[model samples]
Target: MKKKHNDHFLFYSESKTKNRITINGQEKQHAIAVLRVEDGEHIQITDGQGNLFVCEVESVLKSSIECNIVESWSVKRITPDVTIALGLTDRAHFESAIESLTALGVKKIIPVIFEHCRKPWWDKWRRYEERFKLKMISSMKQCLYPYIPELVYPTILKEVLEEDKTHMIVADPNGSTLKSEIRDKQTPVTCIIGPPGGFSATEISEFNRTKVVYVKLTPNRLRTELAATVLCAQIIGHTL
Candidate 1:
């Protein structure tokens, strides 16, 4: 096998018990037309579920490509798994935000609908589902991270408050710095952020009512997109 960019070669979205991996859609197009991979060539494949399947090209077709699985293994999930619950925002901006988070190794992204969030932001995901997904996929490829962050939908803040498995951290300018809160090193963290205009008073009261921790970075307020990523990146910084 010839060497290329070893950080990332290619990946399959699906990996099961079979000895071969079948790749279709844009992955196939890129492999055949762009990468110019020939038979017997080696490529990396991932199921986006912490598993990496090393494979060799068996055959290439117009619509898809086949590769014989050479070996397979799983990467351990990141410790202190972080989930970013993002309130809806501009489509392009949210896409960029999720893309950056996925690259940074976030385990999950929940597209939340807060009380002050714009009404149109609720179902906006349905419109750009494919494009947003592609953004994360491309981000994963660029970063050479095998596991793609799980994307969840327009959940309400109240509903998110119910998840007890994660140590929920809500973002507020009045809250403490990111470095200060996770000092206890809580695992399976879920950090929640408000919309462009910020969370409503009632929502804050509800958050306070819960056992959730309130945390912030600087006295200077950051945009929702930057804030969400900053919190996640900060978690990684502390964890590592």
Candidate 2:
């Protein structure tokens, strides 16, 4: 069998098919200073909006480089409309959760501020997003996935519960097994996991009133990040 050609490439919105693509700004720096891609080499570019282009380098220069598009295709790889809302935790753990969920093919991620959440790191929110996007891009490249997960600004936990209409499952240590709670369900699902200290009594009551089912992962308690991963895995399996 002949080897298959890699046709899917991601580029910026400004890049055009016939025009020479001058890779500049931060992307240029990374390509030249870091990856050291040379002229005549082929690469894939995406607009991060499902548009992909295959291109070959025409010239390489400091701060900028030019490329010619050889072929192009639109991608349609996206997970089912399953969203995840996670209570804000420490920066390190939260970063892991964001990257893991993005790699797992989540549609949207909302950072939830719960009653037991630590003080908000308002100033570093943008940085967190940048890091998450970087992770998503890397995962997209590795997994050959076309769709990028959207990260929503942090919101109050109650607000998410009120706004959510899909099947909601809250990871609770004192709740029913996830397998039992989610088995045979075919609707779009949204999972919520609380912070390290867990949800307060008042918050639990609010979620209960909203008809959010509490699902437990295991008998032994797990960290907030771990719980989120477990729930996401289960949801993905159901969708598959």
Q: Distance (Å) between predicted and true CA of 6, model 2?
A: 8.5
lDDT of every predicted structure (CA atoms): 0.80, 0.73
- Candidate 2 — worst ten consecutive residues by lDDT sum? 1-10
lDDT digits (tens) for residues 1-240 of candidate 1? 453325457565663457988888988887777888777778888888778887777788877778888888898776678899998887767888998998889988998887767657546567777787888888887777788898977788888888885488988877877776675545789998888989888988888788888887667888889999888888888878
**Candidate 2: tens digits of C-alpha lDDT, residues 1-240:** 222234443434345546566777666776676666778888777666676767788888866778887777887544455688988888888878877776677778888888889867844687667777776766665555555778888898778878746578888878787667664434667888888878899997787688888887888888888888888887777656
Off by over 4 Å in 1: 1-7, 15-17, 119-121, 183-186
Screening candidate 1 with a backbone cut-off below 3 angstroms (N, C-alpha, C), the clashing residue pairs are 176-216
TM-score of each: 0.92, 0.81
Q: What's the number of clashes in each of the models? A: 1, 5
RMSD of 1: 2.0
After superposition, the stretches of candidate 2 with alpha carbons farther than 4 Å from their true spots are: 1-22, 180-186
Q: How many clashing pairs in candidate 1?
A: 1
